[model samples]
Target: MKDNPLVIKLGGVLLDSRDSMKIFFDFLSTYFHNYSRNLIIVHGGGKIIDDMMKKIGMNINKINGIRVTNSSNIDIVVGALAGIANKRILSYLKRNKINFIGVSLSDGDSVLVERSKKLDFKNHTGIPKSGNPKLLFDLLSKKILPVVSSIGITKYGELMNVNADLAASALAKTLGADLILLSDVSSVLDKRGNRIDSINREKFNALINDGTIKNGMIVKVQAALDASEVLGKSVQIASWKENNEKLKLLFNGELSVGTFVYK
Candidate 1:
């Protein structure tokens, strides 16, 4: 029932399980039907993309779990991962009576971006570094679900790949929406791998840089930092492992189940 919308990044793997999704969809339908808040669901396609790569005999290389998208990988990623996933999500939303639309980063409008000079992994690895958040806000203001991929196109008509985490952060900042990141882990865990629950931005950053947080998590935590710094919004990292309260607790009131990465 709030004027500000919630920007949710739907993890690609979450769509794999039918039983789990049914529960999630039901919860989402109930939440949105009763709550008047605007929500823009952004998603990733890591799992699906990996599957396609295997089937096609494409070599999958990862520097800290991010796909090294060469020309060949990019083709399958856009078609199988982004395209197929978008349709599947939209279909599920339709069944629950939650209105939504599948939109490519370019579908809505030109998501102008500047790619690295080449596949410069030493620098940006050829992935597009910037985006146009105005496209997301325009759709959000009009009550569109606006599912987005991490792809972008430059003004000179160059298509490029971007990270979903980065894309979601940019949109949240531009629109000033509550940023919610869904993952497989139960929020930001402590050194012993236990759920840390809630903490301020200062603490989170300190832990991350201090090696208390390392590897793949660094990317997600950093994305939250961008949202908080750019838009003054709070970010939450929660897991779906515990069943019902996985996502709802952060929206509606509940108990400590995940970490709230906030400013």
Candidate 2:
């Protein structure tokens, strides 16, 4: 898919640091101006949501890294992710003079989702079932970058709290795009805490079985694996904390600084 966009997913911690965001926008500004490539950004704000809920006297309930959301707190989830976090990123893009549109997973019918029965979240949690990337494609055709939040809706118009990693995968699949999941970790680690330069399904399964990958990393890696398989390409797990030069190199295909998960 030569015409496909490049999807970059941002981890929430990067949102907390001005220097990190500055470097990110600096690299993006250059890439947008020089490369003339289409780009899409999917973001998570779990830490921001946690802080807001804590301030409002709401309990931070979660099961296996998925927030255990309910009708009572779904509003807060929406406000935190789509409202606050989304605007915060948009502010950076605007400052950089990047032509962009801010949206959520639900906007433009980009991602269709429903209640996730896999978990007992007591109410409104969702998993992406399918997608229609036409709206995103239209934006890309016009060379407008989209900054998407991990918020979705069901057929019946119910709000959903989706995992950002999974949201990015779903979008990349629908758009037939290459994905880069930028988190705080430089790469996937092994049992000895060394970086895994590359991984395949078999090795990934072995790592999971032996308990080397746990917590949030489990979900993030699984998302990358799923995207790799679907797209028939390798997916990268890199850190957003890296400096502008490393990010530029990564984007330019000049260097490999992260774990590449192959199908």
Candidate 3:
């Protein structure tokens, strides 16, 4: 790997299954154990938190598939998403004897919330505060992995919702990482159920216009767009569920499979 950082956006599905989750950690232990590259693992806890809420008999209210979390749920979400998940990953690294350190948004006294005063956007637009990139740069320079949670802190001293995809993309821009979004599906599928192997702005717009790309992918596409604009490189979306061989291929740039949204 290059000296540049690698920001990995891990979705909720990766932590949903017991077997697959174990495999994910095992794979990381094997492949990235001593890999001399900077990494930041940003996690999503949608399914995990939702399931916990259901277990506790809280009726879920979702708007556009994004959970509507109140202040009470914020603690629950952060506990599960950041505490449990982050600890599990850190434990795996320790068990494997990998030199890794885990930290969160507060580790450096930084906030990554949306609608922040630190953001320099106009009305009708909003962005998460660009938490001092110097903070993350220093962590990476130390060869430590800063594991991030989806929940972020706003400038108003309140916790706010943040898309893990968008956070990873923005982190990559800030850290100049070669970002990779690992998800359950192999890639964005066409209306005919075929995988989109490669994509650029024009082709992606065509797919959206033709209605082959819609729904959850809208946020993902926008994340990729923002990362590419800021970092001058594309974000790759690959199936985290694929066996080691296929994963190796994509990580090694073989591109035998997976979808790439690039400039």
Candidate 4:
């Protein structure tokens, strides 16, 4: 696997956990500085968006874990994701003295999106059709981390909401970077709730068929599988809740703290 650059997808739950976020960013900043690894962060703001919607008296809906976003919802999503969520992450990075740039998938046309074809949810939900990785590449080359919000824009100048895991997959494929999906859960769990250390495509399919993996995990696993297959490498689904020592071991390849989805 190419080692210089890494793409990490951060779940919304991380944003809600102050302590976890503190440790994560502290370790991340130091890791980046010490290792000089190029990093790109794609973040989800679903919980924040949900809270925003609740405050505005707007009902929220999801279809198969992907939000059902209409035109009206797009405004709220953008405000929550691109606006509040993105800025808050930037603030943390700033306080930590991390060199970073906050951007949307639409920035510099980094990702070209089309209305999601797989799900017939609504008018403004999108999936990345293609991406121009120039901006990301340029930033990474200069050692600047790109903190991306999972918000996209179409050719006709319409904003759309994207599933952050899928967005990270698309970006990883485009940049040929290692993909790491960090979430609250330690790793993909089995029916008995034990963490599965490794999963190949066949095992992944089996788990899905047996209903061992459902809900949001379905999307995360799918994204990891897609990146693994397209990039001919493994994608990791790890926990942000792990302490710094565990995280260090994980980065050094000494301890496997997560499920490795192999091609």
- Please, what are the lDDT tens digits per residue for candidate 3 over residues 33-98? 545666678877777777788889887776555556665576777777777777776776677666
- Alpha-carbon runs more than 4 Å astray in model 3: 109-111, 116-129, 200-202, 252-256
Q: List the RMSD of every prediction in angstroms.
A: 3.6, 2.1, 4.0, 2.2
lDDT of 4 by residue, 71-95 (tens): 7788999999988888888888887
Best by TM-score: 2
* TM-score for each model: 0.81, 0.92, 0.82, 0.91
Give the per-residue lDDT of model 2 (tens digit) for 1-263: 13457889999488888887888788788878778668899998999999999998999988777788898899999999999989999998899888899998988889888889875646888887448889999998888899999899888888998888778888888888778999889999988989999998899888889999888888788888877876778999999777778887777666789999888
Q: Across residues 1-263, which tens digit of lDDT does each residue of candidate 1 receive?
A: 35677777877357787776677778888877776677877777777877888987888788666667666566777775468777777777888987777775555442435666745633222233324567667766676677777666655565556677666666665566667777676677788877777667688778877778888777677766665555565577776555655455565534446677666
Candidate 4 colliding pairs, count: 0
* Candidate ranking (TM-score, best to worst): 2, 4, 3, 1
Off by over 4 Å in 1: 109-112, 117-143, 198-212, 241-246, 252-257
- Considering lDDT, where higher is better, how would the candidates rank from best to worst? 2, 4, 3, 1
What's the residue-level lDDT of 225 in candidate 1? 66
Q: Between prediction 1 and prediction 4, which has the larger TM-score?
A: 4
Model 2 residue 152 CA deviation in Å: 0.6
User: Which one wins by TM-score: 1 or 3?
Assistant: 3
